[model samples]
Target: MTDLSARDIERANFAFSVYDFDGSGTVDAIYLGDLLRALNLNPTLAIVEKMGGTKKKNEKKLKIEDFLPIYSQVKKEKEVGSYEDFLECLKLYDKAEDGKMLSAELSHTLLSLGERLTDEECESILKECLDPEDEDGFVPYAPFLKRLIAGPPEEKPAEAK
Candidate 1:
């Protein structure tokens, strides 16, 4: 808490408030994981449980004060996926080691494997991250992975007319 910048604290507080749906100054323990993710901390289920997220709703609750420490701790401890990590995973699909793969295969994997993204979700990612496929239908994956890892571009505020 002491080391977090004012803006970081403010962002955490705002995220906490959004999840504190009842205005009760507390959030259900089950939502702890969601709150952590909302703050852009990718805590695993074990980490969430260690931080007091209960499997059952209302079994426990977290006040903003309590959440701040947990958020700080997880933020410090969690290592987000790096570009190399993602590339290595994608490499399994790129048998030729050509740094490119079939765009359709990538979309199929996204929709069918691991976390199993919904059609809309997969489409949204493809729309944003994919480049124009070549004649043979292959696409370079490094740029796509880079954009995906970087997340959506930040929206600029509209100029006052």
Candidate 2:
């Protein structure tokens, strides 16, 4: 936790709301895959194999702990931390003001991380994350961020702007 700031911890906690697959308040295997792939990691079958088969082959959830490895890697490579650093990283993935990102947003976010995704893959990702309402198809940011960092289910997280 030495590398993590209070804000970084908060950001990671907020990220868990959507990333947590089992609603267990703990990230598991599937969640790791999603976050890794979303961040543009190769996400090979071997990685899935390491999960003790608790996760399906194609599942997309992850244990929050799994993220520590990647975070460590990123920190080593890019020296990651700082409230501004966390904000910039999150902003790359958050497309709309509401702070929630569907699959498309995630794909674009990965792109910003230097990954390339096909249009078909992007479409598939959107299909996965989108709420299926809003003909214009925009994800709301505030509630999305709230889901990540909202205090005690009744309070708002501090506004990012």
Candidate 3:
């Protein structure tokens, strides 16, 4: 929390609040892993335990104050892979050397691979970043991969005349 910006702290608070279902000002311990994932942190069960999360229902709870440090620690330790790494991996399936692959294959890989995404999550990404599938169901993958890694292109600010 010490190194986080005001906006980042605000976002963490908002995410934590979502799981505080009972308005008890604390979240159930069992939800810690889900909460961390919701905040884009890839925390393992050990990490969750170290951060004071317990699997026993209603046994422990996390206040936002306690959650902030955990969020900051995980965020600092998270190592997002480089864009080249992703591109290389995707190229393995690009048999045609056309920088395109079947849209269905891409979705399946995302749904089944490491850190698997839920169907809804996969669909959300595809809807946003994927081009319309061709008649044969292929879609250009390079651009889609770029968008996935770097997010949508930012709009340029209007220049003052």
Candidate 4:
């Protein structure tokens, strides 16, 4: 197994804490879906279907594990979230002025993780996060934090034959 320094583990735990709504320790698909929903992305069966392959009539629900490939890909594409990085992200996404985030806010926050986002992209992201269904089109901070810290699954050890 890869050896992670204590700081790395702490950072990971902090990240997890930021999103783990129920305090389950790990962030799973349901939580992710909630996060997406809060962000106004509302990832549905359609989106999950697109993630894996052709959409099927009776497709198996994609769990957090299902996102492993995407997570790995995202980790590769983007740098890991650090303590300061997470704090900065909190500041950016705190649209409600409550020191937290709405799921919709995360789209831009995530985009900003690697590169600067254009005005058009930022506007599009806002559109996605603020649900039209809501009278104000804004999400509260408490719920947002719950979904953000949902951590990745348990680390696996190297194969031993």
Which stretch of 10 consecutive residues in model 3 shows the poorest summed lDDT?
A: 74-83
- Give me the overall lDDT of model 2: 0.50
Which residue segments of model 2 deviate by more than 4 Å?
Answer: 36-62, 78-161
User: Alpha carbon lDDT of residue 100, candidate 4?
Assistant: 47
lDDT of each: 0.87, 0.50, 0.85, 0.46
What would the per-residue lDDT of candidate 3 be over residues 102-127, giving only the tens digit for each residue?
99889998999767889999999999
Looking at model 3, the pairs that clash are none
By the TM-score metric, which is better: model 3 or model 4? 3
Q: When superposed on Cα atoms, how far off is each prediction in RMSD?
A: 2.9, 12.2, 5.5, 15.4
Compute each candidate's TM-score over C-alphas: 0.77, 0.33, 0.64, 0.26
Better of 1 and 3 by lDDT: 1
* Comparing 2 and 4 on TM-score, the stronger one: 2
Error of 4 at 15 (Å): 23
Candidate 2, residue 53: CA error in Å?
12
Clashes of 4: 12
Give me the overall lDDT of model 3. 0.85
Q: RMSD (Cα, Å) of candidate 3?
A: 5.5
Q: Candidate 1, which segments miss by more than 4 Å at Cα? A: 1-7, 54-59, 159-161
Please state the error at residue 37 of candidate 2 in Å: 7.2
Query: Can you write out model 2's per-residue Cα lDDT over 1-161, one digit (the tens) per residue?
Result: 43766675566667666666557766655455465444433344444355332455444434556555554454344322334554555665555545544544554664554445577865554454335444554464334333433222356689998
